[model samples]
Target: MKLRFLPLVAVLLAGHATAQEAVFQTKSLTPEAALKAAQAALESCRKQGYQIAVAVTDRTGLLQVLLRDRFAGAHTVTVATDKAWTAASFKTSTLEFGKDTQAGKSMSGIRQVPRVVAAGGGLPIEAGGTLVGAIGISGGPGGEADEACAKAGIKAIADALEL
Candidate 1:
């Protein structure tokens, strides 16, 4: 009778373990995760001795995470978020859009896109070959400075499990 119970317990434990391993959960980007990503970007900017505003947004062009350092200008948060929105909406880097917008506008049959920040520091976050979101940074020495921070943040958060 004891041997029989032992076999049953072992089988039950094995089944429980198998059930736990079968979950196979996958990670997705969320607002909190976006905030972590923004923090990473902000840290990069700090290393460069630049105070900046960082923004992260979901695929729907909504701001998910936003940050502005103590020395960052008040308005930079909005600007950076707007840039992130533009990047997510347009599904392209703000830098490319900024430069090409003029040429696109200059050419016929191309109209300027509204609310698009062509400046640097805006990048689209892609996951599973899909546009998951975007990150934007501003209030640095220049657009380039802002962009560098944002890029670092995006890369850092790309593979992280979202909470």
Candidate 2:
């Protein structure tokens, strides 16, 4: 009986060693920071004479702020949000992801994933080398323009995010 109990005790000890913590910590942008990013992106696009929409998401790919210019198309809302979500989820710029997922590539299948918009204008936000959030822009002339606006948005808040 003692020998049998040894196995049970060993098992319990092993389980304890491998147990995972019930809680953990994560970092993400505050609402004010997110809104600032969105506003900056919008202003950038406006300067370029492009009516647009901007979306900012926290590290978890959850929307934190969204801003649409007065004349931006209705579709821009969803596109901007999806782009931000894609960037946060993939932890990469949507422009690069779009190229990598092009047809004939192994990652091409990722295009089929809902909410994964493999396009430009989506960029991950990093602070202290850790991803803190993402920003996305839509309704510019094309992907490149949209991406430029997104970059401006990040630049606007870079100082605040630096650790």
Candidate 3:
């Protein structure tokens, strides 16, 4: 009887240890959310009389969605995507990153990295203190205007972000 009880307890312990429950989870931006962000950004820029392109990238710098307004510059697409990638990959706004990169010799070499656009149009997307993605805009008269447009994009989805 004792031996049989020991085997049963061991089996129960093994089953508990082998349970496949997840201890941690990660959040990401959905396609619909990305689309909304891009559209809002484009509209915001249009209101300011600027033809613009917007790009949304996931936390790892993967392009999730892109939108370009009519008459937006041909180069704006690549510029927007690179800016979004830079913000998402680095977990910082491109505007602040540019300033930091240019301020010192030690970090200045970061500008040479491929696909790293240190401009003001890129902004990180965060939800519940976790970075979910980034948005970037281009084709505005200046980076400041581009940044404002990008901010509008993020603002459109602020309620759904659970922030």
The best candidate by lDDT is 2
Error of 1 at 47 (Å): 1.0
User: What TM-score should be assigned to candidate 3?
Assistant: 0.86
In terms of lDDT, model 2 sits at 0.93
* Model 1 lDDT at residue 161: 35
Q: Tens digits of per-residue lDDT for model 2 on 26-138?
A: 78999999998899899999998999999999998999999999999999999999999999999999999999999999989989998989889999999998999999999
User: Residue 10, candidate 3: how far off, in angstroms?
Assistant: 9.2
Q: lDDT of candidate 1 vs native?
A: 0.81
Tens digits of per-residue lDDT for model 1, 1-163: 7887998999999999999998965433687778889999999999999888888888878887778899998889888998898888888888777777665366322324556677887888888767888899898887778878888897787666333
Segments in model 1 whose C-alpha atoms lie over 4 Å from true places: 1-28, 103-114, 161-163
- Measured against the true structure, the TM-scores of the candidates, in listed sequence, are 0.74, 0.86, 0.86
Q: List, residue by residue over 44-132, the lDDT tens digit for candidate 3.
A: 99999999999998888899999998899999999999999999999988988888899465799999999999889999999999999
Candidate 3 colliding pairs: none
lDDT of 2 at 8: 94
- Tell me the deviation in Å of residue 115 in model 1: 2.4
lDDT of each: 0.81, 0.93, 0.92
